[model samples]
Target: MIQRRLPIASASLLGLAAALSACASGNDLPSADTAASQVTTIGVNSYLWRASLEAVSFAPLLQADSAGGVIVTDWFANPENPAERVKLTVSILDQDLRADALRVAASRQVSQGGGWVDAPVQAATVQKLEDIILTKARELRRQAIAS
Candidate 1:
């Protein structure tokens, strides 16, 4: 099974992205380009799964997926490095079809050990996660606008 979250999930970041609709409020969308305009950056958060000091950047966020969520799992340089185990789950919410909207009100991570995604990810894994996240962001953006 795959973990689900919108914006950015995975224990690597202290803060990911979540929004009801990219809006500061429940009825307004943030600058359409705000998310996409922003450079795609990733960092570990203070969650139970603390990743090393490795950082990465890919694409920007640009979507409002209310159905599916984006997930990023992280691990230490050493695949089995217990010290580098970290994972998080992010959820995306699509409530309305208007400009009015609210970004993710809260964020959460499902910390556990199972599969690769269920567990922590390595550097290469990070790249894959980043790509998925960026794509999701853009898809959501288009869907939001269409709504």
Candidate 2:
């Protein structure tokens, strides 16, 4: 009777193991194609965040928060144009790499009488910056896929 019971228990254990293996298959995981575009490991899209940093690397960073998705740059004055200075604020609005997910704001100042005075930022200038950042982000994503 003991020998018979041992064989029955072994069969039961084998059946349970097979069922568990079937459940562990990884069908629910995201596909490689979609995974790159939807990456949010750092609260916002990683590609966009990196591209924004690269685009404004010329200026000193005043504040950078990954979780908040905001990057602020200190005043940067061109060497050729010492009389004018500009500051930049870049915000990542969403976790996707879409055109509408990014916002760029600029503050301009002109040296007047040895003091700085606020000046209007050109709309075209802001638009161009946004375009650059978006293009860089896309390129980064493509590189990620190629690798």
The local distance difference test score of each candidate is: 0.32, 0.94
Question: TM-score per candidate, in order?
Answer: 0.24, 0.78
Candidate 2 overall lDDT versus native: 0.94
Q: The CA-based lDDT of model 1 is what?
A: 0.32
Model 2, range 1-147, lDDT digits (tens) per residue?
999999999999999999778777867554568437867889999999999999999999999998999999999999999999999999999999999999999999999999999999999999999999999999999998887
Index of the highest-TM-score prediction: 2
Off by over 4 Å in 1: 1-121
**Residue 113, candidate 1: how far off, in angstroms?**
16
Q: Give Cα distance to truth, residue 126, candidate 1, Å.
A: 0.5
The pairs that clash in candidate 2 are none
